[model samples]
Target chain A: MAKYSKFAAVGLLLAFPLLVSSDYYRHIMILALMWVVIGSSWNLLAGYTGQISFGHAIFFGVGAYSAGLCTTKLGISAWWGMLIGGPMAMLFGFVLGAICFRLRGTYFNLATLALAEILRLVAKSWVSLTEGMMGILTIQTFRSKVPYYYLAFGIAALCVFAIWAIIRSKWGYYFVAIREDQDAAEHLGISAFRYKSISLLVSSFFTGVAGAFYMNYMGFIDPDVVFSLYYISIMAILVAIIGGAGMIWGPPVGAFIMVLLQELFRSAFFGYLPKWISEAHAMAFGILVIVVIRFMANGVVGDWVKLSGLFTRQKAPIPSVTSGN
Target chain B: MEMFIQMLVAGILIGGIYALIGLGMTLIMGVMRIINLAHGQLMMVAMYITYVLYFYLGIDPYFALLVAMPALFLLGVAIQKYFLNPLLKIDSIIPQNQILMTVGVGIVLTETIRFIFRSDYKSVKTSYSSATFMIGNISWNVPMFVAFGLAVALTAGLFIFLLKTDAGKSVRATAQNKDAAMIMGINADWITQLTYGLGAAMAAAGGTLLLPIYYLFPDVGSQFTLKAFIITVLGGMGSTVGAIVGGIVLGIAETLGATYISMDLKDAFGMVIFVVVLVFMPGGLKELTKV
Candidate 1:
């Protein structure tokens, strides 16, 4: 029954491209799907492993910039740019993870966050290569959003499958066990550091791919726009909290709700209010986070799973059977 | 060479305010174990409170402290009792909910301030913004000295309050061990509320002190908060003296970096201290000093 539902869902997702019309709808779907991939991968390190990283944006920006830089300077294809993007982000992620994961808890969070800021600062000041504050404005853009949409959708689907595969494997069990209690997991012979490093690398790979997709789609890359603190906050908090973090669907759900509502919020309010008085969405975004976390901690889908009597409401069910498998 | 000394003085002075910024964050972390990312936003809010009173109401920025401090304290109490208290039940030290929720509060507060007072950078020029006092070979900006003095006073006052007052002691006790303190009749809830409120109030006061020197903006808090986090980490979380020393170190490093090196890379220098501290002396600079 579970296998049937899963296959049906994937099948429907595949068919989504044929059903959608108009560039606007496709644009939204593609961005949402790209978020789906990026968010899912993030969940592996942050959500599943219980090591909350506030700087996943670093990987994304690195991917976008690397891909952008390679394409522009070396005349590399987007395909080639993307090919290099993941490993670059992963390599950086590995270094950062290796250094910071040594710290116990709060220090680790602070370290990643600092690394993100440093990268942003570097990107901002590195005018010779990155074009500095004016940003890279002339990346190639296709008129139709269809190709980007398909690309994003394919990436998002790939991310989902990758995460699903990990979850079903022994590594996933270790990820869970380590997340739940690192000390206990270590006593049982799990090298918590190795697991975290691997997770960070994998997470960074997908994040960079998403970044490549973003620069290609937007055709612009700048520090403020691509690596803004608030954007990171929006996706990080939304995916992990709203979609029931530590699960597969968290980041995708977060991206969907955040992107859609934000679009509506921005568009509707843009012409409605005075230019100076029009910062309501920023306020609204915050209030909405508090409301969501205060109420639906298990997230929208997590809540639904509870309502449907499928998910047992405890601290995320430890896969006892999979632990020893 | 003379310019170097001047930059060094400026750096230490800047570090004073940075220490003030980290004071509340360190206290809260000691008690609550959450980094309070919105702390910088809180400083922004405090600056706005002072800005509105000074610009709109035509009140003195110093006088704005009277309104801002208590107001922010109440806000903190409400936040702690309502928003953050629930997350305390969770076992994780880095309570994800508190971090996210505070960020939300910061966004709302900043937007509200932006709505009321436009985004124009406002600084209180009380006939002393540009004033300087010269010594044998170097000069110090009067506003820098004053801001540093106030920051010192704030830290001193905080330490005194934590040590001397019964309530403050209870809050400290709660941070040490909530259950053990609760067994001795300390209301952990009350302490948490008081500590959070005190943290916000101190930030408000810090803003009042800072208004004369630093131009106020809705996002200015981000600048300080990042440094404060670095200060807190380098000093060790929950250590007031640590925050103070760490702030001074960061300030000096940033000033020298900005003067000697590229101005753009100034903030990076402070972060380098933070990174090095995190790597070498994870316990904090004090720990390394002890060894």
Candidate 2:
């Protein structure tokens, strides 16, 4: 029954666009799917590997610019970014890890953040290379949302599966071991730096793909939109964190919740609420972060039993052999 | 040579203010073992307080400092007590939960300010704002000179407090070892609260001082937050004197960068220096000073 749920969820998602005719809902789903890719990748690095990155936007922006530049410079279809973006981001990931993996915890976080800021600044100023703040614009290849929706769905599914596979693999254990205690992992002869870089590589690749997908779907790119610390970097963290970090299902759950919340606020609850409520969207994200961190440290999925128990007004059931397995 | 001296003097003057900001972060880092990522947001809140007092009440920014500092101290104490302290007891996968909380707090603070002030670029224009005096070949902005003097005086006062006060000793002790401090009957919880308050107050003072010369916006806190941490890192995580020197160095580097290396890349200079310092001299200036 539990094994079939994954299939059920995927099947439902695959059929979602077909069931829902509204372009509005389709666009929201596409955004949610994109976030799944970004959030899951972030989880793989920060949640599983204990390398909390505050600059996932660096890879994200690189992936975005990789696609955007292909159109502007290479004079190719932006679709090529779908192929090139991941690797381009992975390249950045390698450099970032090489420079930053030497530092631990907060220092690593700061380094990633600082590097991303540098990139944002460069992307804004280097007019010859990046078109500066003018941004890269391209015509959307598909007028129908279905094609983009499916692409986003496919990428998200692939990313989740890859992360799931990695976590189940020996590499996953090494990552977790490093997260638990780097010194202990080292004592056990696991090269912390090597595995961390590998985790970052995979993470950046998927995130880069998402960024590229964003370019193709949105049909436009800007430094402020792509490399924004508040909108992209922190949003990725919020997604992984809101869903429950360290769990395979966490980011997917979180991505949906966040995107839905964002849209609801952005549209002022489908025009029911006052427009002023829409302006408070970022503030809402901030408050959600605080609330989640305060009461639900492990997030909804991680504390499912406790959460459900509250609804049922019953003691959270202790896991029996069948349930535990 | 005159231009060089001008830049140097300007750097030192601004560096004094940066030192005050860095001192706040250093104190928090020393005591809490966590980087108060919202250090600059706290300063921003203080700046807003000062701004309100100046704009609405016709009070001087320097005078506004009295209200801003204590108000921010209380705000900081409340945050430490409620938001950060509880996280210490919660079992979570992420060890940097407190730091993450600070980020959330920073966002909320910035957004709240934006909601109120609407992201307008505001500055407190005083009669002395543009007043200057010539000394030798270099002309000094009067406000900058006064701000520098106030920063020095605050630093001196802080040093005396830390060295002479029993409460300050307890703070240092708690920073050294929380468990040991608890065993010694010092209220580690209260000390953490007090340290956070002091850190916030110092940042508030720095912000209040900067109000005359610098422009204010909701997003300004983030830039200072980056600068504060950079200064803290450069000074060596928990070293006060090191932070002061680091601040001055950053001030000089930024001014020089602005003059010679495109004015736009001035902020980048600090970041480049930060990465360089992290890579080569992880110990920061503290390794050399060892104070």
Which candidate leads in TM-score?
2
Q: Write the per-residue lDDT of candidate 2 for residues B151-191, one digit (tens) a residue.
A: 99999999888889999899888888889999999998999
Candidate 1 second chain TM: 0.93
- Candidate 2 chain A: 10-residue stretch with minimal lDDT: A316-325
| CA error at residue A14 for candidate 2, angstroms | 0.7
Identify the runs in model 2 with alpha carbons over 4 angstroms from their true place.
Answer: A317-325
lDDT of 1 by residue, B1-291 (tens): 999998899988988888888888888888988887778777888887787787778888777878988888998899899888986664322247677777777777777777777688778887888899899789999988988887788788888888999998998899889899999999999898898888888777777788888798777877677877888898888887788888888888988889888998887887877888899888897685551
Query: DockQ of all candidates, in order?
Result: 0.59, 0.71
| TM-scores, one per candidate | 0.93, 0.98
Chain A TM-score of prediction number 1: 0.88
lDDT of each residue in A247-288, candidate 1, tens digit only: 676667777887777665666543675554335677767777
For candidate 2, the TM-score is 0.98
Lowest summed lDDT across 10 adjacent residues in model 2 chain B is found at B90-99
lDDT values, one for every candidate: 0.79, 0.91
